[model samples]
Target: MLLGEELRLIAYNTAIKHNITTSMVHKGLYQLGVSGCPWKDADIVEALGDLGDYGVHNLFAVERIARISEVHPYSRVKGLLYHSYESLGVKERDENGEFIAPKLLWKENFFNRNERGEGNAP
Candidate 1:
């Protein structure tokens, strides 16, 4: 078994390379476990969950997300973040800076808004 520090390093690299966090990696692991992924394939499963332009972030709607994989390819993940955030009872940040997606309908639009500072662009 890998030490916590070693696993942390792996997670750190994953975060840096994928723009996600170690905790998110854990989410993937959680999904894999809940899905009955084999113990020997845990590492692969974790990496798969963390591998993507958007990677994983503990969200998905109309389907199982974390603690469960969404089987990507846009059509599966598209427009899901909004509902994911919604399911958590947020329309965007709630005065403290949580749930920053801003209720957009599509994932690309959300990312576009995010790139433009969510209309803070000037």
Candidate 2:
């Protein structure tokens, strides 16, 4: 098992090279339970939840991202930032700066806004 400091270093280094953050990397590692792994960019993208240009955040999403990037000695989780921007719809930012998906996809498609029926509510 790697020490916490070692994990931190690896995450920090990866973040610096890939323009991410130690916290993000650490979260990925912790989520995936992968160390000294070998994943690729595609893997990272898929691992990141295949969010389809949406900045939706989830534990599984980030975990998959971390696993996928492990293939390369220096891998970066790309496109998520882009997804974050593209996913932003009507809702700007809540008091906590969280981007909330709009209830209506196109006003008329309110019945199927987020693949969820109008009656759907979590």
lDDT for each candidate structure: 0.44, 0.42
Residues 1-122, candidate 2: write the lDDT tens digits: 46667656655555555544555545554444433235543343233333323443445355334333332232344444333322522234567988543221222343354356444322
Q: How many backbone collisions does model 1 have?
A: 2
TM-score each candidate: 0.36, 0.32
> Clashing pairs in model 2?
38-71, 39-70, 39-71, 44-68, 47-64, 47-65, 48-65
On lDDT, the leading prediction is 1
RMSD of 2: 13.9
Residues 1-122 of candidate 1: C-alpha lDDT, one tens digit per residue: 46667766776676677656667665554444434443323353334444433443554411233222222333343334334544543343547866443221344554566697873221
Off by over 4 Å in 2: 34-122
- lDDT at position 66, candidate 2: 39
TM-score of candidate 1 against the unseen true structure: 0.36
